[model samples]
Target chain A: MWDYTDKVKELFLHPKNAGDLENPDAVGEVGSIVCGDALKLSLQVDKESGKITDARFKTFGCASAIASSTALTELIKGKTLDEALKVTNNEIAEYLGGLPREKMHCSVMGQEALEAAVAHYRGEKPPEVEEGTIVCQCYGITDTKLKRVIKENDLHTVDDVTNFTKAGGGCGSCIPDIEKILKDLWDGKVAAESAKPGRKLTNIQKIAMIQEVIETEVRPLLEKDGGDVELVDVDRSKVIVSLRGSCTGCLMADVTLKNIEKKLKEHVSEDIIVEIE
Target chain B: MKIVYLDNNATTRVADEVREAMLPFFSDLYGNPSSMHTFGGQVHRKIEVARAQVAALINADPEEIIFTSCGTESDNSAIMGCLNSMPEKRHVITTRVEHPAVLNFCKTIGKRGYRVTLLPVDKLGRLDLDELDKAVTDDTAVVSIMYANNESGVIFPMGDIVNIVKSRGVLLHTDAVQVAGKIPVDVKKQPVDLVSLSGHKMHAAKGVGALYIKRGTRFSPYIIGGHQESGRRGGTENVASIIGFGKSAELAGNHLSAGNSKLIELRDKLEFGLSETCPEARTNGDTENRLPNTLNISFEYVEGEAILLRLNEFNICASSGSACTSGSLEPSHVLRAMGVPYTAIHGSIRFSLSRYTTDDDINKVLDVMPGIIKELRELSPFVK
Candidate 1:
């Protein structure tokens, strides 16, 4: 069992504001059954006094989440609109004593529902997203902005992009696009850096240099053993090279490629993608 | 906040008097009972006294008791020893809901080319005695059934089982680990050949238990070494724990009537409060035939782990479905044998009372439980 605080227990056992409000001015729903928790909150707004006359909630979650909703409802009821707006998720957690760290998201959900209800009362729209062409379709990331953000954040991998912008964190169908975007940003940075007087070849220029080196130096050595080398493609700094002829079905093909990929990556960038097929 | 421990069937806190009895053996009286000296002789005498005390609790001969490590070891020894005594007789009979100690051992022995018959239980956790009678054959070597289920606390009809086995000239072994100290047991009156008891199930310390082997019954030693437990089980004696077990047994015998009534009352109160407060919650097993201190309830829609975690917030300790609580993926074999629905299986909680449980403790649980269950149910995915 998770170590629960005394306050969390207090609120869970004796929840302050549970159930539903009759004929509420605004209703806010957050989460869903699939997410494992949901909350339906209602508020009675006192328009003349610009205050919340009553607040109630029906929450579906573990003890902490339900307690958070209950405490959030209790904290906002009978308070003015401005006072209710100050009720944060942290404040809800504190009111319920304290919540588990993983369950902090539940408290956030409660706060979101409260804010949504208050926004509904004021006839306000949800915060808008500026129009941009979609890039990472998994999380609906926009290409025009996410590319800039990727560059600004110096993202390098699919995971880094996801963490920074929630791009590949969803279905992961757009992971290849996220990877391509990260590669483009990295290549652009390298190109800009190497264009200076003292700097050298960019990643693309470096891959071309290695391909030339493989054709002249590495391929002839492998051809002597009845084998040949072929360059596939380079994404970012990773060079994809293939082994042909006898090397294709040889037992030592792995050993030959290991030797070649190692030498090429050592002389060039370390992020080379060397595969047999 | 004060902690409320309601998971007594898992294990009980050692009683003060039992602890006191064990204290001396840990220091001044520390001697090998098998050693030949006044120091050892005193320890040997205490061992005898403990033997008699344990025997008296079960109404068996002091000579019949052979101390072993724990209930599991006792069970393994009984089942294996019986099989060894009659190597040609391969058939073994047991109930579906027997503790893993017996069930697993029987399974292992079954793999070794023995024919084993598992008797099924009804919804209330009671075995069909008629079925048991038919399952036993002339070649049956042993009939091993548990006195009470560890999870459901449903007491088995040992008297009927014993009579059936005795008429067929088959040996009977009862894993009385759950029932030994919680209720009265008399091996002589029950006409069982073997019975297993664990000290920790009572208020004694862990690592010490005993198996009762009826006099004139054929048996063999599972553990072999230099003479200890009359060469039945071979190991250096666990003196302090043995003394504690004896003391616990004595106390259990004396307080059986009052302790049972007190525990039952508290259990009923908690069960009543839970059923009244939480809709669609019902007790598992037969209410009247269950162990006095145990109440297993299945709360609809909510999972047992979620409920236990919530109850932990209040410093209230309880047990859940045997599978979830024990880190097994499968639900309890006992509950499954009873044909309990899967919808209710995941939410089952076992609240076991002890002699230490008080009315105030029950009230505190009752007061806090409703809100917890209601809140959890609201969040439950299956709640409609």
Candidate 2:
């Protein structure tokens, strides 16, 4: 019981665009039998117009994996190769009324097969087979692919990276490396834009800016730990807030507050001070 | 749709006689066995009868049986009990294919600075006795192994294991949850220190299990509570389920020899039918040395969850070792430890039968399984 949607079940039972195309323009293969899921995408491309006249997939995986391949084939047909390349893994998941978080790697596999197929058609090296520093030795996932999927899916935690790209799901020896990558990405995003220094913001603008940063950056991390923070008031450089839910009366509240203040300083302003109400 | 359940190793249907034996205790006989009054005191006598019935299934004395909540508690009690009693011994030996109850506990203890040696199995899921002989040391506290694997149905050489571990002057515990009623488990023939048994694996009710601690063994209680189970385990007893377990044991013992022959016939028929129709399918484990009513077959190319779902459409219930079925990213550890190929591991299906399984059930599974595997293989990318 994966809690699969009706659309997923319907597509899995009677998948559209199944099997391989006879003498196709290009064939793309992604994943391997050892990984428990793989897909082979075949395309019929019109040579003059560069439009995909037909697309079919032969997949080896579970219900969600089969449904994802079906959705990918359906999404790519009747479009130019460039337009087909723009379809994200998220859209394949959305076409099936969303997939389980653990099975998101299936959607990622579908997207990878599409890219590999187009790369083959264009006489370029298939990106799926391109070599890089392997982060997950079990699945052969590379650091470059990990960073790309993390950015594309807005993945915040190492668990999310595993769900999307299967980077740290086996043996778990690379989790520290994944943590460092996440930290580097977060730090890079904050350091790239630091409120343009000395742009004096009005009281209302500062409040709204802090609120936006907290919602976008701080809240997601806190919610993962079963806690919440609400902005109460802004007084000059000091910002007041209330810790709610599991955050209240927790022994790690001080550490959490320090982290929050650090995030506020990195994203909002240097003089920003956080105080608990 | 008529349901054909081949997942008996997961759990079995409660027998009619066992259910009838349990119904009285839920209301009319709802009396604490420890009460001082005669009405409640009468219930105590019935529990002792159950203790004798369970003891009779295995060739242990009635006093050796310590009723626990379930098989997991019995396993935990045996391992933690032995470790706590012998604080000086820090090393333990076990196999890689044990049930999670024992494997996970050993892993937790390993993190806590205890030495654990997990013996590896060969491709046929057979233990290397020479490796076991060398692994045992004076510092070893206990050696725990399962009687038969749940997923593969591969039976280890428990008789040889008992001799090897016992000769080392160390305690040995066997998780016999899958073997007690399905096969003969005679404590007299092979005297192990502890044996854990589950009721629901037989035709008994859930929530009731028994652990046999051989007399004069160093032991400590895992759950310390109110004075019960002779202070080895303490809690108010699960009265109804225990009674059902007693009745099921009685029934199992009554027809053990006769029922096994019939089970073997049906299991072989189902295994033969599937293998004949799908020549690419291969049976896993040491088929010659497995349980009579268990068959674990693997089909290449197709994923197991996809095949199982298609089988479900025909109301044919079975179990699989696929990563998708268990919410893990890898197939079963049992299959993995045996070096089963990834091409087949993801498609492994286990069908465990029981005495109640009829010819029609086996026929139903045989008739529909080939079609399901064939359909899934067509959709697989690896299929040529």
Share of native interface contacts recovered by each model: 0.10, 0.69
The i-RMS of every model, in angstroms, reads: 11.7, 4.5
What is the per-residue lDDT of model 2 for residues B218-240, given as tens digits with 9 covering 90 to 100? Answer: 99998889778888998889999
Model 1 ranges with Cα > 4 A deviation? A1-277, B257-259
Score chain A of each prediction against the true chain A by TM-score and list the results.
Answer: 0.51, 0.70
Model 2 interface CAPRI class? acceptable
DockQ of 1: 0.06
The top-ranked prediction according to lDDT is: 2
DockQ of each model vs. true complex: 0.06, 0.36
Scanning candidate 2 chain B in windows of ten residues, the lowest lDDT window is B105-114
Whole-model alpha-carbon lDDT for candidate 2: 0.89
